[model samples]
Target: MDPMKVEVKKIDELFRLDGYLKPFEREIRRRHGVLREWISKIDQLEGGMDTFSQGYKHYGLHFQQDNSVIAREWAPGAQQVYLTGDFSK
Candidate 1:
């Protein structure tokens, strides 16, 4: 699979199913472009979509072999965060 080769699927089937959607086709394509840009950015910054999407496995509570609990959160906007539970106390 060549990285430069872009396989574009036509949306003609959608317009065939409903003529009303034809007017909004341009907007749909623009939105797809935005999505592609975001995907590219994530691939460059986060080492590809597979690792970026699997953040749940890293950014949450986990138990270690020593019976210790680790709590982690990614909150960029919050001024403060608190972890409360039987293990946290």
Candidate 2:
């Protein structure tokens, strides 16, 4: 499939933001680019938004067999994380 192209002039005209946003045009364009990239990625993801966002269900805390508890989290960028709690009564 051919990648979609974003035309800045068409967007500027459609939104009528050029006059009011001229001073910040560059920043606006950069943010628009980031949004476009995100859109493209979401569109390419299989099973759409529901499957992509189901990450929360797989992360976090849960209860397991034999009356035990489990905790989990996704923090790829973090150097370390410590889980602290008084699970004992």
Candidate 3:
């Protein structure tokens, strides 16, 4: 139970998740070509990881560390959006 082993295991877990998400990602790209294209661009942007992986940004998509949905939608058109959620109250 060495510390290096622990780090390696964690990295392996991420690789597994990356592998698992890879197919779903492809499916997403197929189903939502435009969104997938935007996602690819976002991945290229530094701000995206901050917004996607952490709640440190006040814009774009927000996701938990594990990628559980917190919020999203980079769409800026059709001004005036709403989130009818329990958090509103």
Best by TM-score: 1
- 1-89, model 1: which lDDT tens digit per residue? 23223333667787889999889777766666767889999999999999999999999989999988788899989999987656543
Scored by CA lDDT, what does every candidate get? 0.78, 0.68, 0.55
Query: What is the alpha-carbon lDDT of model 2 when measured against the actual structure?
Result: 0.68
lDDT of 2 by residue, 17-45 (tens): 45776666666667777777777787686
Q: Rank the candidates by lDDT, best first.
A: 1, 2, 3
- The TM-score, computed over Cα atoms with residue i paired to residue i, of candidate 1 is 0.71
The predictions' CA RMSDs to the true structure, in order, are 6.0, 5.3, 15.1
Residue pairs in clash, model 2: none
TM-score of each: 0.71, 0.56, 0.23
Ranked candidates, highest TM-score first: 1, 2, 3
